[model samples]
Target: MQRSSTEGPSQYPHCLSSGRTQEAHLIRKGEDMENENKKSIKERVALRNSLVKEALAEFLGTFLLILFGVGSVAQTVLSRGSMGDPLTIHIGFTLAVTMAVYVAGGVSGAHINPAVSLAMCVLGRLSLCKFPVYAVCQFLGAFIGAAAVYGLYYDAFLDYTGGVLTVTGPNATAHIFSSYPGKHLSILNGFIDQVIGTGALLLCILAILDNKNKGAPKGIEPLMIGLIIMVIGVSMGLNCGYPVNPARDLGPRLFTAIAGWGTEVFSAGSHWWWIPVAGPLVGGMVGAVIYVLFIELHHVDPQKTPEEENSMKDKYEMIAMS
Candidate 1:
């Protein structure tokens, strides 16, 4: 049949519209199927135990911390300081801390250090019951991280030490895994150094997290904390190498003891094994208490003061008139 010009235009557009409508419907159907598949996978794999999930996060976070931090030290020591310097160790730890926090902060707050966990508990930021579990996971993670570094650098270790590991003297490699006091440092001085260093750490952390006191900008807390660690390591690392975290020190120490260095890692620094553990625990609490007394307690009420309230009211009235 011959069609009028108007009828042909109208029918052509209707066919085009029908085709477009079918295309849209097909697209929507495909999207719906994809979404359903994603939902099914999530339902099957999602963790049900909150505690276990958090523990795994803490474990992995601490593992990453020790892996890089100790790996840096190993490189420097094995290369006889030719590859990297003391500053390299500090920078490595800074990056390690920052990255670890980013990896686990959402789930476990990345308390890779037992001292930090205990401090959070004491400050009421973390539950007291969770502290033990978090601490244990952190320790285990550090232990595994140390093992990884040791295995990775096993050839370097043999080359550096000639297959003999000692805790002290020219070829001692124990300090690569754990902290040891300098020759000039006394046991008492080492303990004091750890306390001061860890106290400063906790003090700065509490200040950073206090919103009323103007906490760090969102998404930068991990970086800030990492920088704080760098500062502490540079400024206070002379004595006992600033092992402010019990898990950071002990886990690697235990690993070294088992791996090859024997028990001397614990006994070398005048039986200094306990100072890093006890000092940080005490110092963290002290720092948290100090922050609460000096700054946290002094925050003004969130409610607006009468003078500010009247100022706001006057501004509203001025806006209405304008």
Candidate 2:
């Protein structure tokens, strides 16, 4: 979680090198083979603290988000206009965001949405090396969650469609997994809607996390974020079903294409599969740049980059150890 300044002139930190130093001292004295055993323990610990852990956390958090969100949609659609309504879905996604953040916030920043991950990377809040890892894990988690939802509602899915899965039939199932723009909206207009919706989502995210800008009272950000998702869902859903997150939409759409929904999942609404993926990434970056220009540009503070801090720590540690 933190880099210490006193690394003692070694590639590893003070704690890591202390054992090596002792081992080297003992080897000269021909004491024992105990130092060899110590080496493996250090390697194991280092591996545990690496990017793999963060990716797993991202995966689990995204899984929670997609599983429940898809489940809510299935419940609403399968009930044939009876069980759950639009509000039910809004609450489901709101809770999904809240619970997913709680699940991964401590470890991976809980960037279950790829849009959020991209925005953070753009803002220098996260390492670029970890971006692809987080994105892949998120997509995989979403895909698996959608698959699980399909399995959970297997009976209902078959009953509703008579075992024939079609995008625009009496038993349409694709919409439950991926979004489709309303009939009244043009493709270009739908794309614009996605841009605006995701842009707004990212803008609010930046505003809420800005400490200098009176960010959300700590511990309440996740809740407030959920409310934002709910509000966006209700307010901006008329045009394109409000897919503000790429992973939340594309991952499930891909799974549906592979699972049983056929290519119609992709071909639906004029090959509309790519909008959610491309729009959010572009919108997030725009939002980040806008926030920085409006707020960070005004504030004048000398701050060290994380890489700089880590490198400085290495030098200090080496000097101290020497």
Quick one: best lDDT, which candidate?
1
Give the residue spans of candidate 2 off by over 4 A: 1-47, 299-322
Q: Compared with the true structure, what per-residue lDDT tens digits does model 1 show for residues 1-322?
A: 9867777656688788999999999999999999999999999999998888889999999999999999999999999999999999999999999999999999988888888888898888899999889999999999999999999999999999999999998998998988887889887888788878888998998888788888899899999999989999899987778889999999999999998899888888789888888888888888888889999999987998899999999999999999
Model 2, span 18-77: residue lDDT tens: 889998997876644566568768777664665898999999998999889889999999
Cα deviation of 143, candidate 2, in Å: 0.2
Tell me the TM-score of model 2: 0.78
Alpha-carbon shift of residue 174 in model 1 (angstroms): 1.4
What overall lDDT goes with each candidate model?
A: 0.90, 0.86
RMSD of each: 3.5, 15.3
Candidate 1 residue runs with Cα over 4 Å from true position: 1-31, 302-311, 318-322
- True-structure lDDT of candidate 2: 0.86
Model 2: pairs clashing at backbone N, Cα or C within 3 Å: 5-317, 6-317, 7-317, 8-317, 9-318
Model 1: which residue pairs collide?
Answer: none
Native-to-model Cα distance after best TM-score fit, residue 286 in candidate 2, in Å: 1.1
